[model samples]
Target: MIGQDDSRLHTAVLVGPEGERRRARKARRQAAAKVETDARRHRKVQARAKWEAEQAERRNTSYLPPAGEAGPAALRTPGRFRLPKHQDTSATLAGQYPFLAEAGLGNQGVFVGQDLYSGGSFVYDPWVLYQRGLITAPNVVLAGIVGSGKSSLAKSLYTRSLPFGRRVYVPGDPKGEHTAVAEAVGGRAIILGHGLRNRLNPLDEGHRPSAVSDAEWAMQVASRRRDLIGALAETVLDRPLSPLEHTAIDLALRDAVRSAEVPILPMVVDRILSPNTADDEDGRLAEDGRLVGHALRRLVAGDLQGLFDGPSTVRFDPSLPMVSLDLSRVAENSTLISVLMTCSSAWMESALSDPAGGQRWVIYDEAWRLMQYPALLRRMDAQWRLARHFGIANMLIFHKLSDLDNVGDAGTAMRALASSLLANAETRIVYRQEPDQLGSTALALGLTGTEQKLLPGLGTGQGLWRIKDRSFVVQHQLHPAELAAFDTTGRMTSDSHEFRNLDVRSGIPNDRRDS
Candidate 1:
């Protein structure tokens, strides 16, 4: 009993202290819980008030629309809120216009016409562009369908440049269309044909460049003669010359050049056909050149005779404002056409090579026909590459850009040569093209879909001028006299030859001849 009583007393003492300690811990915990609840409630109330204030501020605020408030700034509309579209002049909108457009080839150069897009005057000069560093190459390629006024644009480009001290050289005018212009500009057209008495000797030492010494001139003359013979033979042969044939040609040409002061093609042909007996030790020289001789014989005795067989009847005067070789008479003969072009191009080469030969315009109308022959194409390519050095710009006018693909089979050297011509040119003028040609034209020129669509709709005298990366839709303008001179519709007139009389409203005559 005593032990149990003592244990109860110890237990009671320990239990009493433990109970107080537990109550104190519970009270501290309850206080902490209450403080935490109060802090959470305060935080929730503050957050709700802050959110309400933000909502009120947002609800009360008002701002301008995304389309903008006024003027050109009003171009944009906010949140699909619509604003009526207003039309304005491009000149006015250009202040901050939202679209891209041709800024006009600047205010310099020749005045071509008005830009149909920017509504500003469009000026273009290859030399001026090159001077401005707008183009590295001053060459131009103009393509348009027939009756699309491409010829007039070509004529205008050179004729208009006359005042700028730029002379024009039409090496071979197949249609004689430029003859009148040549004469009108105080230039001469060397007309050649079976009946007409104009002879162009390929051996004639053409315009002697100022830089060429007498000895150099002699060498140049020899080289030109050899090249002319080779080109003529190749054109006629429809293939490049063989090595043996080349050897025969070199010997024959040297002999001919040494034999005469002004060697004619007939001498070369005779020498080629029947080589010098001394060099014919093997008797196979004639056999080697038999084919080549006959091929070149065509230029002197075959279908290409009478044109380049004798000494040139007319001279190529670089001093003239323009010089054109009229080849309309023999237009029916393709071989003869190529031969004439070759001879005339060679004749122009001398003047072209002259450093003193001031800036000139070389126009190649109906470019498709001339590019057919490999020899002529090479000559043209050389000229194009040397255009800048010669102080001249070459303009190759085409019926269509697709004509380039027709040059040769794909991946062929001819095709590559043809494509390089287009590549070197930075300024490409595309006039009206048929729908069928739109895709190829676009691909060749990198035209946008909109531009490709615009091709078929372009009217006469209107063209898409792509000057580098910039573009312009130009409507070419001309004076009354220019219109009359550039008219190509005379042959397409009505069947009835009825004449319409013009009443002399002013001091004019019914027939233009009366003036």
Candidate 2:
């Protein structure tokens, strides 16, 4: 029996050893499979690297220097292209492309670039490089010693934007560039010529100008004008007016308008302009009164009434796609420009307040003039307040930074205001500028050395486009037709001139002429 038990134990031990050998064989097979998989992956990586090298070679072969650069291929190092640093980051990569950024091929927008020699180039990119919607509407301040293509740039942008279905409302001064674009884009161009008539009149419909009972509209207009009125009074009166004083004046004006038999603006003006019995050294007080009176009279009797009470007062239609307010004709009348800007602010406020989501853009060329009026300044403030809600993007064009110096506190307030606009913009396009203006523009736009270099040697239409957190600058080219359309002088075409005569009555008052 002992011998049999020993034999069974020996057999059990042998079987156990065999089982262990089988398990080790299975483990070895698994390890071999994993190694094979890794080898395959390595081979795939090598193939990809080889393909990439070939692509690089092809790209290098295709590289060409900027059109005018005189260089042989051997002498010139090919331009190195790398993905923008912002693209590597998680934040901007995920964020929407703002209009301030150079739009890409994926965004379905066109990036127009121009050089002094070739005129312009148009690139259609469907992708947006930066989310323009994120930026604040820029108030453009264009300044040049009269021949630097300031007006042309404005017209180019306006015309280019038309095909995209933007509504541009330009209160054109007599220069007529804005009017021409409006007509070109199938928009109604109302020249503020002699005896301009309103197609729709709230007054004749047995409705008072303010009788619509739009409390919101009244509040919006008043709110936007508040700071501006104070600023204006300070400038005109040569003394700071307290908030309480401003409120009191505002209330008095409202009460006069509400209680008056005739239009209350004229009455309010008279009251504000009435002589102050308190002091004799009140030259500023008298001037303030006159300016205020003049402004009010112009508001009451000018095309501004149409702006406030006509079809424009109705909310903008997102479906309409594009709208342009030609203020070029009204540029001469600083007060009128103020009124239109005020009306635009109020209108934009109303439009944005509507819950149906709509995106809009406001482009201002030579916007420095707009800043001269406290009302426009206040309107810009309102734009800042309602930026996100309205999805309104502003593209401001300016030739030099110093041009802003003419507004109010010279360049200081202008700089501050511009800074606010810059802070809000997600993308900034800087064209060629004088050396002195470079630092301020860079500082304001937050540009890098590459971007700064892009600015210095750029031709007329070529410039650097920078986006927040972006490392690379994009070269923009404008279309040839668009380049041809840019108006160096604010002149109207023959058709536009004939169209101006179509309206017999001038929209502007004869007494308070523009400029």
Candidate 3:
């Protein structure tokens, strides 16, 4: 009975409230086991996701070729890299190596200066480029505002070329900027203006080519003289000569040549005013030439007296390193300037026609002033077209490209010729320009957007050079001596003896100074 009671107590302790607690504990243990199993499954799922992420990262990574391995399959080939490396240009390589690139005009020309973009030494020689088939036309067009160092660049190009056996001929230096340069380079500058003893006889036989026959020479002389007289008359008259006026000029030129060994403008004027009895059948020859005669008389005895009234006191020798006609004195008078330039143009033909004349540089400074006259513009156009045949390079320098529109009314022959001058030149150098001129300049040069944007921000001595199909932004460097000799702003900068030597009040240069 005591054992049974103990058993019941044990049972009660185990199965009653105790037994209930024990069963609850058993259920809690079962539930705890199930929670542990669920936690393990969750950990396995997290591990699987981490493993999948690692595999995906490995698959997305770029796979470069293994060391010393060479095969198409070794690399993750991009669509752009399919072409052979040797078949592509660096311009294409920029897409690959965008940080490092260099495109330069080759290494066989003069050391011009520095290439502002590539940080390389810039070199250029037009004759060399032409021989290499890099450019078809050797002429150049340099445009810049005043005081942009365009003057110095012009001087340096030709002066540096002197050692290379090239000569420079500046047909007209309106500011007389080239006077000092010519003297420094061992060249001659003919000074012609009022009160100067120097005289230019345009009728004199110019430099004769070695290949011309007597007949050809005679024909050239007569044609040149007749054309010169007609040009002078037209320029003074401010209109083209009529057919009757042309006939009168031809008769007068012939008679003058027949009478005087060295004909003068006075002779032509007098003959035009009073023709010989034989040529004036109905006395209409004198009437036809009367207006033209008085017009040309200005050069002999009127406002343009003291120059071209007599024989040429100075001769033009083509062998000099440089030759320039200083026209600073007459720049104030448009008519006088045009007349002088017309005479100089006739003079240039003499030297330019010589076959024996070596390669030369013909520079037209202040071209805006020269292009205003139709006669001068025509002569310039002819010379520009014949640049290649004459073995010469013509450089036209003007202040602004808008000067072209100012050359003549739109669609006129002057406008066309002026526009053609720009077209013929394959080498175009643009210095800093005014904001107003940027559009026309960009259009005229076919500059890219970046290039067009580079104009206004350009610093001094920097210029954009477009040579044929290539382009370069170069910083022109000059020696101290060159800066001094090529200086055109002396009057505005520092007043020196050289500046004082010029007509100070009138702003004329020292054209006659032996400096």
What's the TM-score of every candidate structure? 0.78, 0.54, 0.78
Q: Which ten residues in a row have the lowest lDDT in candidate 3?
A: 76-85
RMSD per candidate (Å) reads 16.5, 16.8, 23.4
Candidate models: Cα lDDT each: 0.89, 0.51, 0.87
Better of 1 and 2 by lDDT: 1
- Residue 231, candidate 3: Cα error in Å is 1.1
TM-score of 2: 0.54
Candidate 1 achieves a global lDDT of 0.89
**Best-fitting candidate, scored by TM-score:** 1
What candidate 1 gets wrong by more than 4 Å, as runs, is 1-101, 494-515
Clashing pairs in 3: 14-19
Per-residue lDDT of model 2, residues 317-419, tens digit only: 4344344445554556666555555444443444544445344556665666666655456557556555555555555656665555565564565456655
lDDT of 1 by residue, 179-201 (tens): 98898889999999997788888
- Which ranges of candidate 3 are over 4 A from the true structure? 1-102, 495-515
| Candidate 3 lDDT tens digits, 1-515 | 99899998887766667777789999999999999999999999999999999999999998755573476755655565555547575458767877673477678766778887677888777888888888888899998887687888888888988998999998888889899889988999998788889999878888888889999999999999999888888889989999999999999999999998778889988999999999999989999989999999998889889888888998888999999999988888989888888888898897897878989999999998889999989998999899888989999997888889888899998899999999999999999998888999988778787677778887878999998777789999888887888777777777676576787666667686444
